[model samples]
Target: MNDLLQTYTFLNQAMQSDSLLCLAQAVCWLDPLWRGYDEDFYHDPDGILSAALVVTRQLFPDLYVDAIDKLRQGATYATVDQLICEGISNTGIPLDNLEYLPYGIPLPAYGVELNDADFYTTHPEVIPILACFGISPEANPYHMTIPDCVYTAAEIIATDLAKRPEEQYQQVAWGLLWLTSATNNSICDWDAELMMEVEPLAWETNDLAFARVMIEEADEIMGDVLTGLYWLTSEPAVMQAMQDNIHRIYKAIQKKGKNNDAPNIRLKWVDLAICPE
Candidate 1:
């Protein structure tokens, strides 16, 4: 477990560097079992390394992929780096071009196609560094909590804040937008219970994050119910589930902040009402 953690830390630093050499080191250090493990490794409970790898792949696509490919082909971790250097020496991609800050979701891009409310329930702000990647919906900065992402990301946020807490917090923002829809007979008659409920729309937020929140002292949002927040079309109801999930992440951050000299958690909800007019 300690070795895995060391690897996870090294991997985090390497990706943060966003440098090619570090990328090589990061990929070269993966455990063989995990190095060549299939995608299901993500579902496994021991996915500490998985979340970091997911972000690292995005940070250094070419070299990371090269190293992983070589590892799968039986190259030792120690040699894969040299093999990659020998194979192709292209200049590394600079992630500085990406903006980690998240912005309002542009529903038009996806056609506001929320026949199912799940369409708008998305959390791209989870990784603020990803904002440097792109603002379009496709470049969503978030990774599914997967039980690992939130904890991992929160740790990153807390630790990173130590160096420049002010800016680190500014870089990443966590936003949750949940969408659940149903066919409405008459738009604004929700009190009459006139709409047909839509099946669960994943859209955003968590399972683990939600669990974290429920256990904490969330007296503020206790009365909160549904969060679908808009009416004209989807009539996204404002429900407790989404609010609860976001709060849970806040609690997790606070729990992790024990290490931070001054842990100031910044939690925000993604308002889906920004939909197309």
Candidate 2:
């Protein structure tokens, strides 16, 4: 089996026994929070970060475990809050510095195309697992369905914030997006109804402080994500565009800050994408 499938199988077995919860909790506690309402984190960033953490520890335990321990020693809701403030406070780091080796989610060969059935047939065990979440796997070879199993497995090890009902729904929504991104070779129509659960939870929450912490922690933990997803946070234009979605939560619901973060993030993007390599 490919290393990616091997790791997934291991995690799958572990989840079946519910033995991985502690480790999942440990990562959630130590790493940044992915807010449910925030599409950037829940939809793509959180899953990327979680997959990076899970894979890094699985592949290089000493390096990742030690990092987690150290981060935990100093981690808190407040420290992470500061990190996001720092991210927003300054132009922030370049996207390249944030990039990491891409993780396993099989892609099609160059110039080749794959449909949903291709993924399901290749991984026969995935269909039923995903069905548990009401996300059916029925697309064709031209349209690959993201087996719900992946999201279900991911949620098993998701950040603590995902435990919140609103956040949990958002994470699921994000999980949908994450799967599509990983399968970049194919296109899937994302479910828009999922946002209904996310917006209200993100906006109605009594905990802006928690949301702030999730953002900051997401900033720090993702700074070194093994998956190349740091681009979501590092590239100014792309990151800003996504972050703008977060601020939209602010506008559509809270109507607070002036979305100053977007332009500043854009400046950071140019520096990363155009400046010296």
lDDT of 1 by residue, 132-203 (tens): 111223434243212333333434433432343232122221111111111111121121122224222121
Each model's lDDT: 0.33, 0.36
Give model 1's TM-score versus the native structure.
0.15
Model 1: CA > 4 A from native:
1-52, 80-277
Candidate 2 lDDT, tens digit per residue, 1-277? 8999999999877766784786776556555433222325333353443443443444434444544554457564334334332332232211121122232221112111123455556645434433433345464345554443333333332332234344323333343334433322221222223322233212112333443444454443323231333323333453343334334333333332443231211111123334422
